[model samples]
Target chain A: MNVAALGAAELRNRLHGDGLVYRVGPYAVRLRSSIDQVLSAFSCLYADYPVEPDDGFADFHVYVHRPQNLRRWYRPQAIFEFDGKVPFKPLPFSQSYPFFEWGLNWCVSNHISNHLIIHSAVLENRGQAVVMPGNPGVGKSTLCAALMLRGWRLLTDELGMLSVDDCLFAPVPRPVSLKNNSIDLIANFAPEAVIGPRCEDTVKGTVAHVRAPADSVARAAEKATPRLVVLPQYVEGANAQLIPLSRPEAAMQIAGNTFNYSRLGLQGFATLTRMIDGCRCFEFRYSRLDDAIDTFEQLLVGGEG
Target chain B: MNSGTHRWSVLPDTVLHWYCADDETLVYYEQAGTTHLLTATSAEALRFLEYNEANIGELVAVVSQTLTLDVDGDDEFFFLMEALVEQLQKLGLIEACAH
Candidate 1:
């Protein structure tokens, strides 16, 4: 792969004095570091598409080699880089960050969309996709990771691209970001799961990326009409519970949670209405991952009550 | 204050609720807080919201003379006006003027 032939090296830098340049999409981005760092980030996120050259003008190109560079690049509306830092507040250390590169990819991809990009997990069973959209500590990712391990096809462990018009969810299928106890929990719960190295002292405590099941990666582009849009809040020592949500409530919730819902204007509204009409909305509270997975599986097998 | 005072600028003749704000345009719904994206025709009706309390008789005259109504004579035109008005009222964009 001739790197120069693909994209014009836009930005250049040297990491630890290593001459490194990144071909962003179609444009070659020059940076200061080993391409290994960039490749590592790409691997963490599971970006299978080829390094497209001179893809033309991008929204922005940035480089992250130092720890403090994390704070500097935080404001990109849409970000694309790999750095070890925790995005969640009350910064959890002791545990290393898993999949910093994957996390960065998720941010950039989600930001590019003219829809609300949520930090949630999405998975599909049967033909319909179940999207769990919410904040970082919601256990949405854990549940998403577990289900994917248990034969549910993973669409995304972090972002769900939902079109309001057809109400269909396009698959992102990135690596699942598991933190602290989640890393161990999944390892113990499903020994077959592929858990990555942990990066310490960032946000959300110690973090790691769990590689998506191979079947999911193969079918990463599968699109499904969202059968359900759920907001899950996980609590320790509590039983799993699924609460019903009305169409109006769902619409409002999605609108509020959507990253760029208001940005797409009429198109966004139309798409959102279509999504709300097509799917059932719910608010779930669960403590145990297996129980949550079972309840969702049951709903998929039978019509929801 | 007066619901009928201001009609949604984007939605012309049909009923509308100025429900959402977008980057460039505003989202006007045919019903208040409802899910339906106002069809073009319904959006056209939103133009009538610009008028301050125009009655069905006035609207029919305007819609008919200014554009195509697809209806027969004055009676049918009046019926269409009434229906449009009813939808507008449902959307909370217009009210029947005391006059």
Candidate 2:
């Protein structure tokens, strides 16, 4: 029997590239990169999502395929391809690349009503999603990696896709990228966590990815309510702290941090305003992962009372 | 050069708002957020907001005349007011009263 006969959840969707194949959740993705690049991008970046060894068809079936033509030309990003045509561009910069992570962001956002995609990381536990939104190098990935290891279910390390209808956020749990000292820090902090090999000399400094929790990966499709909207910053400080921010302030920050806020234009502004009004906003600063985790647990456990 | 009861500081350009207190003021926009406080200029700008809706051309004329400064060569006065007003508009503090 061929690999297709094995029954993969992602068979419904198919993507084709040079010689590699990708099974993005329920979709298939193909890339035109060498085996090394393909493996490095997916295997290393998202080690926790898990990939079944190929029976005899091709390399590991990937859900996301960053094309070779765009890889050299554009930023390191992921894409999700769908069976039917989409009204929006799949990649952040469609003109420069064509790749999508098989997390079904496009499908869910397209099908689900009242939910708009917000650029941030989402972690759900006990029906509550903690939204961490910020620009690059704000310690979001590091904090997310530490949270996943400590017990919070990893929703997504990037792209905190928020729903407008139910006021909930769905997890897109990709890989938690650790830069420079982060890899070592997590290794020493949580020895049990499975981390991918480190790739040296990238733009964001020497980088490696830490795997998400198995349970989170299993329930990747699940969506949770957004409780707190945090703008976390990894400052060299003595104590982890959370500072309250007003709705307008939060709105501006959330708007600034959004992936397609400007792209969404007026709709984006309205969605952002609604999101800020619905969720509590704060500025979090931390040095120790454990300290940060404790603070988050307190917030999540306390609920929005 | 003080002209009509223009409320030089009480103009419409001050329509947008962020965080304001006794001495500190914070302004937010799509581009970035800025904070202003008790400075003479900010006070004057805040006063300008009273007019409901005004642009740089009007604001420049008012400030230059009120301060008795050379209205023609002071690009700094015009430039600062224009940028601040743009940010104020972006923050929704002031809507385009023009149309």
Candidate 3:
């Protein structure tokens, strides 16, 4: 059953008690929290995710709790605990949901070694996936959200999980975090997009999350062969264009973006080389989402220029 | 300058992983954990140096013959080969033999 099927009281009970175990893409997460904001965020953002049975093993056990000190009465704060250990400093109590999302991303990127995780947003179109690798505030998430609204299936909004053996991208579809001005930008761009509550202040400025489409969450197990690697730059007022990149240049750029390339050693080199061999690479610069979408659509039909 | 006295050889214990596609070659140096893209001439020079260590003049002569360039008459070709050797040495891919 999906999380939406449960009544509010039951859902709250599950979260406050033994935790609500749910399947999120390739991993099962057990989330425990007494914070009302976190519960509200999960109820809205994760309503479509499947609720796993208690017997199944959870890949991550996470908790959001208020500190017990008198500071709770003065200035309340929320701490994120993973497997009973705190990995981050306490954030303001209002920032619980954003902290949960960031903490979960941290868990997957740091713990999962089987797949080569890259700090990129991945999406699929016509059975072909495009991996968009970029640094923070580069509009990677904004572009990803725009594409998803434009009928592209969201594979992931943060992690580009590439299988080590097959070089296929494993789907880890989750809420797309929109930071600062992009939150309002996406709201205006895709008026129909479902966005959760905004967590103001804290790190990364004000942050909000856009829920992944129900179709993407349903097809979580499906993987896609990466056919293109685009390093995107969202320059203001710049004309939208795709510049073809040499295989060697693309390979080196992808290696630099990968989280575990050095940790995986020679195996990482082999996997990346194989991916670069099959995909057309590009450096995409754009300011307009519509123009970017048109260019990418033409690319799919006509192949790289 | 005695061509027979100088030799060029790849650094010992350095591992290189190569990926060649459509006239482009990428070499990954295992020791440094760095990947580099090579021009056709540079790729050919490295491939030649992998098996045989040759002096600058000898390398220039052999590479000129392999690439079908007449370095004997072309000053640009001669300097290109000289610069290529220096570049490879700076990258730690090859070392000059001590006299």
Candidate 4:
């Protein structure tokens, strides 16, 4: 049964007790938290994800709870625990859901080294993937969310999981975190998109997460061969433009944006080289989502300049 | 010529990884963890020096033969070769061989 199948009280009981083990793409995550906001956020955003069997193994056991201290009564905060040990400082009690999301990203990026993990948003169309590597405030996630609402499937919003051997992109298909104005922009652009509760006044300004499309989550096992790598930057009032990049320039940008490029050493170098050799690379700048979407559609049809 | 006595060789103890696409090449220096983009002439120079150390005149001759540039009588070709050598040395990819 999926998380959506469970009644609200039963789901809360499972979370408060033995934790709710749920499937997230390739891994099973057991999340335990009594925070009403955390539970509510999960219910709304992750309702489509399957609930794992009671005996199944979880790749990560996570928890967000109120700590036993004076601060709980004063200015309440929530601490994130992984395998019974807290790995991060407590966040404001109001920000428990966002904290959980950030903690999960940290767990995956730090622990999973089998695939070359990149800090990028990955999307796919017709078995071809486009890897958009960018830093925060670059509108990477905003573009990713917009594409997912269009025809493209969302592979991942935060991490690009690439197979080291075949260079194929494995799908993670998690929620796309939309920050500040992008949240409202996406909501207006795709009125049907489901966005979770907004957490305001945190380090990243106001943040919200758009639920992964049901079709994308269902096809999470499928991998796409990378065909394009685009380094995207959002410039307000700028016309949407795509500039071709040489392989060497693309290599440097990919390496710079990669989360574990150096850790893989020589193997990483070989993998990145092969990936660059096989894909067309570009730098994309845009302000308008509709124009950007049109340009990408042209790209898919081999009509890009 | 005086150029014949100025020998050049790739720096010792440095592992280089290279990726070439048409006329452009990227060389990754493992020791420094840096990647340098090279033009066709510069790439040819480094590839020649990777296998054998050669003086300025010999490098120019080898690179010219590979690139089909008329360095035998072309003063401009000679000047370009010297500039490419200087560029490689500055990038720490090659060094002068002791006499």
Largest lDDT belongs to which candidate? 4
For model 3, the superposed segments whose C-alpha errors exceed 4 Å read: B1-6, B62-72, B81-87
lDDT (C-alpha) at residue B54 in model 1: 59
C-alpha local distance difference test of each model: 0.57, 0.58, 0.87, 0.88
**Chain B alone vs. reference chain B, TM-score for every model:** 0.50, 0.47, 0.78, 0.88
| Model 4, residue pairs in steric clash | none
DockQ of each: 0.04, 0.06, 0.55, 0.46
The alpha-carbon deviation from the true structure for residue A52 of candidate 1, after best TM-score superposition, in angstroms, is: 6.3
Could you give candidate 2's per-residue lDDT for residues A1-305 as a string of tens digits? 22234233232222233323533232233333332343444443443443333332432223344445765356644433344333333343321121333234444434433446655777877777778888888888888888888888887776667665555665566567678888899999999987766556544566666766757766766777777788899998658999987656666666666555555544555555555555777899999999998899888777755
lDDT tens string, model 1, B36-76? 33433344455554554455555655556545655556586
By lDDT: ranked, best first: 4, 3, 2, 1
On lDDT, the stronger of 1 and 3 is 3
Model 3's chain A TM-score stands at: 0.97
Ranking according to DockQ, highest score first: 3, 4, 2, 1
Candidate 4 residue B93 C-alpha distance from true site, Å: 3.5
- Number of the top candidate by DockQ? 3
Superposed Cα deviation of residue B64, candidate 3 (Å): 4.2
lDDT of 3 by residue, B20-97 (tens): 876778887888776778877787788778777887667777877786865686767656767877788888888876
Off by over 4 Å in 4: A303-305, B1-6, B30-34, B70-92
Residue-level lDDT tens digits of model 4 in A1-305: 88889879989998998899998777899999989999999999988888998768999999999989987878999999999889999999999999999999989988887788889999998767999999999999999999999979999999998879888888999899999999999999999999999999999999999999999988888888888888999999999999999887788788888878888877777888888897888999999999998988878788233
Tens-digit lDDT track of model 2 for B5-98: 2222332333333443333344433332332222334444545665544556677776566656685977787777676666544544444443
Worst 10 residues of 3 chain A by lDDT: A296-305
